[model samples]
Every structure is written in structure tokens, then in C-alpha cells.
Target: MDAAPSTSSRVQFRRRNVASRARWVEEAGAGEVVESKGKLWLTTGVTRGSKLCYNVEEIGFLVEKGALILLNDKDEMIGIEAIYEKIAVGKYGCSWDAFQAYKHLKSLGYIVG
Candidate 1:
């Protein structure tokens, strides 16, 4: 019989779980962000779906990608042009992104809130 391959040093992956944002980014590059068990999970080596993050929409716009859309927890594509416009005009205000930013930074191993 043929000899079996040795595999005792490889780390196993935990599905529906995220290691960290910095780890996710380093491993995923630009993978979709998923919220599982109240934590962000990325497709490290598995297939999932796409949900755009609007915080970097400016870069997308600058890159000539046109209007950017975001998705909710349900993974539905939704427009946000009006919201950006409102933000630009100070018609609407928000701190939701701030919270996510902090969470992301923290997940990325930063000393942020």
C-alpha cells in the first residue's frame, strides 16, 4: 500500500468565524465582509458573496467605479448616493460608521476603541 501523507502541523480553519480584521484583510485582500455571531467573517478560502463597504467609496469613485452601493445583513444591494449627498450637504449626520471603524481597527489589532 502507498504511504499516506503526513499532516500534523497545519492549522485548521473555523468556519463562520473570523480571526481578525487585519488577518482577514491580509488573507482576503478584498473579500466580502460577513457578520456571523455578531462578528465580521471573511471568506478566507471559501466562497460566499459580495457586499460593498461604503466607507471607501471615495476611493472607488476616484478610481472611476461610479456610484457605490452597500448591503445590509441580509446581503441585499442598496443605493446610498442620496445619503452621501446628504452627508456632503450636512443634511444628515451619522456615527454608525465610526462604531464600525473602531470595531474594524480593534479587530485589526489596533489600540482603538
Candidate 2:
């Protein structure tokens, strides 16, 4: 009988879409005006035979002068101005704010293509 392969020869599988937390800010009678302080799993832009891959990252938030701020691991401010400007004009209808935020982040080089 042949022995099984060593531990190093075994392939490891990881599951995507793990759970995380998100903070929602609501206005008086408005319902979920903003969301912040969450850990999101973002794609690394690598495709495996047609499927996309993602990894998790921690995010922080700050509301300053009516702007929704997103901070990095070093607590540095990542610009969300373009996103806000786009939203103000009602251009991002049908899509939720989360999606818009993702797009904005991607555009800013935070996420790879």
C-alpha cells in the first residue's frame, strides 16, 4: 500500500463571504442615511478561472462637517469627496450606497483591478 502525501503536499481550501459588522447612521425619519465602522472583505482583483477573489480589511469612520470619512489601518483619511459629489447629483440611483462606496474606493486605487 502506498502512503499518503505529506502535509505540505495537501491543498488548502478557504471559504469566502465570511461575516462582519457594519454601522448604520440614520436621520430623523430618513432611515440609514450613512454607514461606517465596518470590516469588509474586498476583492484583490485576481481571477481564478473566471471567478474573482477577495480578502478582508478593517475600516473605520468619522463624520466631519457632513462628510462620511473612511480611515485606513494607519487611520489615514481616504478621500470620499468624489463619491459624495456623485451622490449629491442623484446620479447613483437604483444602486445602494454600499455599492457606490465600493466603486469610489476602487476608483481611488484602494482596490486593485
Candidate 3:
């Protein structure tokens, strides 16, 4: 977290799919895998929290927008700025806007991914 103003246009955020309030609280292991809607989701171990197991582009979208804050192996919240750099190089994933949309829909009781 460098001291950049919150409104900076350089924030670099974009989402490629539907999002959810579900924080990817931790990187999942093969042990946490679960299946729903014919898609695999992992029990993130956040008191029943679940995150769809997936890829980099989408993850970058989330991190850049401040929607999904991924925790490192050490359990530290990753900053959007660092993610933005990686995204530029074509790595990482998740949708920040999708998370926002997921939260919005969840308030209405819709199960979103």
C-alpha cells in the first residue's frame, strides 16, 4: 500500500464475470475441493465460506478493483497495486466488480458465484 490517493485512475480494475461477497480468505488446497452447479468450489475454511477454484485474469480484475483481496501463503492481504503490475504481465485473477455485484445480489438472497 503505497500512499496513493484512493481516487487515482491508475487503480486499474475490471471484472470478467459474476462476483460474490465471498472473500478468497486463503489459497485453497486439494483437500478443500467441493462441487456445486457442476462447478468446483472449495470450502475456503472461513466458517463455511466458499470460493470458486479458478484462474489469473479474473483474479487480477478483482484485486485491481479492491473487490477481492487475496491472502498470500503468509495470510497477508495483497494490495491492488502489486496485483496491477502482475496483471499487466498477464498473471492472476478474480473480479472486484463481480464481488460487489455478488454482495448486492446476496442481500436479496440470491446465490451468486
Winner by TM-score:
3
- Which is the leading candidate under lDDT? 3
Error of 2 at 75 (Å): 21
Ranking by TM-score: 3, 1, 2
TM-score of each: 0.22, 0.19, 0.34
Q: Lowest summed lDDT over 10 consecutive residues: which window, candidate 2?
A: 24-33
Could you tell me the lDDT of residue 57 within candidate 1?
Answer: 24
Q: List, residue by residue over 1-113, the lDDT tens digit for candidate 1.
A: 99999865222344323222111221322224333232222212234354432232221221122212234335554344533442344322224464345435544555531
Better candidate number, 1 or 3, judged by TM-score: 3
> lDDT (0-100) at residue 99 of candidate 2?
46
| Per-residue error (Å), model 1, residue 106 | 27
